[model samples]
Target: MDSYAIKYIGLLCLLLAFVSCKKKNQNSLPETMKKDFVTINYAKGFSIEKPASGITIIKVYSPWPDADEAFTYALVPKALQTQPQLNEKEFDAIINVPVERIIATSTTHIPALENLGVIDKLVGFPETRYISSEATR
Candidate 1:
């Protein structure tokens, strides 16, 4: 091969190497972008009280409408006997409840609840006409 041909081959090889490197970097993402959890310190405004063994009560504002009282619950780690079938692996970690009773407050939640075969548990609803389908009604 001549000097020009050798030079052209070297240039082509360098271009291919750069293209492959760029493609590899595009496939990989940073750890911060992949993280799903967000930590928040909300203990500043709330008053913590110890009731008994394995019971800690905290007074906090309600996240729902028409709630006059501060929400209180027994913060305990309960074990699950049976596992539910979830679409994604992350959903298994997040959802711990059996979801026996579901209150459809809006039209958007009605159709999905009906499809999941748990429509009978929907004892309370906002408005029928807004979410009532032909079959659901």
Candidate 2:
């Protein structure tokens, strides 16, 4: 092959190797309270950890069906005015306690929120027409 062809092949091979290596760096969660996180097993889909008082870490495994990875959310008290001392990579999002507003996506969640006495916090729901609860309607 000519010099140009040989160089092109070398660069292509290097790019392919880099892409393969990057894919291997991704991580996933089992939600069974793996070795790294504290064993506050919430369920097969999530794990709860309390690294500090009034601060909760909820690691949701497989956010979507058969998802390859997981997401972690930090629920901190609004009064704290600060986040917990955890790794920057530990959580994907941070939410405040006493959730002021809610947008319940599932009908199943509505009953539970109502029973918890926090149905008033629901500001938005897609399927309000399907609800039979007079209080929620």
Each model's lDDT: 0.55, 0.78
Candidate 1 residue 37 Cα shift, in angstroms, is 9.4
- Name the top TM-score candidate: 2
- Model 1, range 24-122, lDDT digits (tens) per residue? 446645542342222336644345544333333344555366667564433332342243322343221232335556677888887887788888778
Worst 10 residues of 2 by lDDT: 28-37
TM-score, one value per model: 0.30, 0.59
Model 1 TM-score, all chains together: 0.30
- Which regions in candidate 2 have their CA more than 4 angstroms from the true location? 1-42, 82-90
Error of 1 at 137 (Å): 2.5
With a 3 Å backbone cut-off (N, CA, C), the pairs that clash in candidate 1 are none
lDDT score at residue 135, model 2, on the 0-100 scale: 86
True-structure Cα RMSD, model 2: 14.1
lDDT of 2 by residue, 26-113 (tens): 4755543344456654558788776535577888898889898899898778776464454567779878787899998888888999
Off by over 4 Å in 1: 1-96
